[model samples]
Target: MNKNVAIIWGGYSSEIVVSEKSMNGIYSFLDKNRYNVYKVKIDKKGWTAEIEGKEYIVDKNDFSIFFGSAKIEIDFAYITIHGTPGEDGRLQGYFDMLNIPYSSCDWMASALTFNKFVCNNFLKNFGLNVAKSVYLSKDSKYDINAIAEALKFPIFIKPNTGGSSFATTKVKGIDKMQEAIDFAFSEASDVIIESFISGREVTCGCYKTSDHEVVFPITEVITKNEFFDYNAKYMGEVEEITPADLSEEKTLEIQQLTSKIYDLVGAKGIIRADFIISDNTPYLLEVNTTPGMTTTSFIPQQVKAAGLSMTDVLTEIIECEYQKIQKSL
Candidate 1:
């Protein structure tokens, strides 16, 4: 019997487009012979499941869809929502209450990694290299001069809890700091500002199960813009090099670091960690628990470079989580 699986997407954030792309990619990769897959779109409008061009509302009480006289329940959820309820742990909490198996970190881990400044600082205590940064909340009073002196110029201002580089800015001087900060705050209630680290930008993906651990190859990112912003990420304004041009030792170092971070954060399936290699040290940029899965996204790129099938990787995630749930019961 095939279990019903839901590929959830369409978040309440600017990253909704990215989420939709990921959902499509997963739908193509999942083994139809093994599981009955459905596309579940969760947006501000409502929760809906699209089946054969028809939309059915999902029952919040049980997370199910009624088709005619049949009620289909979701056995597993492959969440691709990039922000808000999905990536920040709100959805995870809801699923947890229903004993639902999901393909991502738990609520605690998701919440921790979603907050850029706090997650980096938390890992810094374990001797990880991260750029110097300042954090601000909606109610906090910030002195522009004090911030400029503390972090210097050529800094990055971005929403502390959002992704897809929406409302992120690279402020080259103090003249643009306030404006950049305001732009970032428009996207999130909190903001994070960090001193710029100039070097090669690379990202590595990793996932672990009770049986084995897999770390995909690194990808070197090149962009003409000031940083890898929204345009470079989705508008095709950048070049990506798989199996990044690095020596064996450096490659091993990054892969090992990625795996270590996975354990440190108690991460679950399919997380990607980005870094900036400066002065021969990899500085932690940010950890993405729910990484993009579009055909051209970094995770899919890395997976292909490793000569592995996305189908098999996703199967491992589903089976592993399912087994864990069964054992707990």
Candidate 2:
């Protein structure tokens, strides 16, 4: 019997666009012969399922859809939502209460990784290399000069809990610091200002199952812009090189570090970790609990570089998570 899988997408964030693209990518990668897939959109509008050409309201109580004389129950949720309710653990908690298996980290892990400042600081205690950063809550007050003196000039200001690099800004002086912070705060309640590390930008993806631990090849990001901003990420302004041209030692170290972070964060499904290789040391940038799944996304590119199929990877994730749920039951 084929399980009905809901490829959940859309979130109350600017990253919804990326989430939609990821949802479509997952839909295409899923093995149709093994499972019945459906598109479930969860946005400000509400939870709804998209059928052939119509949208059906989803019953939030049971996470089901009622069509013409048929009640389609979702046996699993392949969450691709990039931010907010989905990536921040709200959706995960809801699915947990329903005892529905999902294809991402649990509520706690999702929440932990979603907050850049909190997660990085937490990981830093474990001796992980992370750039010096300052956290700013919406209501918190701090002197801009103090921040500049502490972290120095040329800093990166970004939303503390947002994804897709929306409203992220690179500031080189005090003149633009306030403006950058405001830009970032527009997307999130909190903001983070960190000392920028000049180095090659790279990201590595990893996932673990009862069977094996898979760490895809690292991809070096070369952005034509100042940094890998929104345009560089989705507007084809960046060059991505899979199996990043790094030394053997550096590559292994990065892969091992990524795998370690996954276990430390108690991540599930697929997660991607970004880093800045400065002075031959890889500094942790942030952990993506729910990475993008678009065909051109880093994960897919890395998977292909590792000589693996996306269909197989998706199946492995679903089966492993479903089996865990079955055991718990």
Candidate 3:
């Protein structure tokens, strides 16, 4: 019997476009021979399943779709939603209550990694190198000059709970601190300010299969823009080199740290970590529990560089969850 899979995408966030794009690529690569897949879209309007040019409202009660009198039961949920309920543990919690397996970290891991400040601090306490930063909420007031003085110039102000650099700003002086904070707060109530680190920006990805727990090749991100912002990441404004030009020793070190962070965070399906290598030390930026699955995204490119196919990557993710479901029964 073919397992019914719901490739969940679309969310109420600035990254909705990213989610849609990545999900389209994922839908194409999912093994159609062994599984029946449905495109599940969720946004401010409602949850829907668009199949065969006809749209059917999804039954949130069971997360299933109905075609006239027939109901499509989802055996596994491949969550590709990038923000909010998708990345912040809300969707994972819902699936847990329904006893439906998913292809991402558990609720706790999702929640922890979704908040950048908390995740960075947690990893720092674990002896991982992290940049110095300050946390703020919309309800709290901080002296602008004090924040500037603490972090120094050329600081990064970003929403503490969002992704795809929706409201991230770089401030080179005290005059820009408030503007940056407001920009970040517009996206989320909480924001973070971090001292700038001048170094090579890179990222690494990892996933757990039925047998292999692997880390893909590291990629160096060099951007024409100020930093690796939304444009650099999605609009092809940056150059990404796989198998980053580093010594064999440097590559092994980052790879080891990547796998260490993955296991420490209790990530299940696929996780990618961004970092700034300062003088050969990898400082953690953020860990993505729901890394983008689009064909052009970093994970896919890294997979290819590591001599792995997208088919193998996606199958391992889906089948890994399927096996866990079997074990639970």
List per-prediction Cα lDDT, in the order shown.
0.94, 0.95, 0.90
Summed backbone clashes in each candidate are: 0, 0, 0
Model 1 deviation from native, Cα RMSD in Å: 0.8
Per-residue lDDT of model 3, residues 93-199, tens digit only: 99988889999999999999999999989999888999889999978868988877787889999999999988999889888788889999998889999999999
Name the regions of candidate 2 deviating beyond 4 angstroms: none
- Full ranking by lDDT: 2, 1, 3
- Output the lDDT of residue 24, model 1: 93
Model 1 compared with the native: what TM-score?
0.99
Poorly placed runs, candidate 3 (over 4 Å): none
Error of 3 at 85 (Å): 0.5
Position 181, candidate 2: lDDT: 92
lDDT of 2 by residue, 1-329 (tens): 99999999999999999999999999999999999999999999898999997999899989999887899999999999999898999999999999999999999999999999999999999989999999999999799999999999799999999988899999999999999999998999999999999999999999999989999999999987999998999999999999999999999999999999999999999999999999999999999998999999999999999999999999999999998999999
